[model samples]
Target: SVLEGGTWAAGRRAAAERRPGGGPPLTILSDGTVF
Candidate 1:
């Protein structure tokens, strides 16, 4: 999942830079159909 790789992949170079505690990105939107 992109979420796991981008914002939730701790200690992974493929992950995006985030806050110290793995805070979510500022802009994300989805209906009730996805995670």
Candidate 2:
């Protein structure tokens, strides 16, 4: 699961905490691979 405790989850948690809506802190590319 994406929620599993790992580097990805760590970063996700960081993003969630940084943003108001739990969204990424940066703008994602239209290609869907830049975030």
Candidate 3:
């Protein structure tokens, strides 16, 4: 699932960057595209 994968990646990146709320987490629509 793109959403799950993206969100996981985003969380890792955010943690590495030390920015808990730096921006929105990645999301995916029914079309399997990030939104």
Candidate 4:
């Protein structure tokens, strides 16, 4: 299922805060996929 807008927005905000420089702010090191 897709994530809700509020949840996704919050995640983006958290990611931005976590990586303010913003090259690739978020990374999910799975087999070969990321959101």
Q: Which number leads on lDDT?
A: 3
Report the Cα lDDT for candidate 4.
0.49
Q: Is candidate 2 or candidate 4 better by TM-score?
A: 4
- How far in Å is the alpha carbon of 21 misplaced in model 2? 9.3
Lowest summed lDDT across 10 adjacent residues in model 3 is found at 26-35
Candidates, ranked, TM-score: 4, 3, 2, 1
In what order do the candidates fall by lDDT, top score first?
3, 4, 2, 1
Encode model 4's per-residue lDDT on 1-35: one tens digit a residue. 35676777776666555454543523522212244
Off by over 4 Å in 2: 1-5, 21-35
TM-score of each predicted structure versus truth: 0.20, 0.43, 0.47, 0.48
Model 1 agreement with the true structure over 1-31: per-residue lDDT tens digits: 8876564444342233333455454322221
Per-residue lDDT of candidate 3, residues 1-35 (tens digit): 99998987876654545434443333232223332
**Residue-wise lDDT of candidate 2 within 1-35, one digit each (tens)?**
65555766665556555556545534332223333
Query: What lDDT, from 0 to 1, does candidate 2 have?
Result: 0.49
lDDT against the true structure, each candidate: 0.36, 0.49, 0.51, 0.49
Clashes of 4: 0
* Candidate 3: residue 35 Cα off by (Å): 30
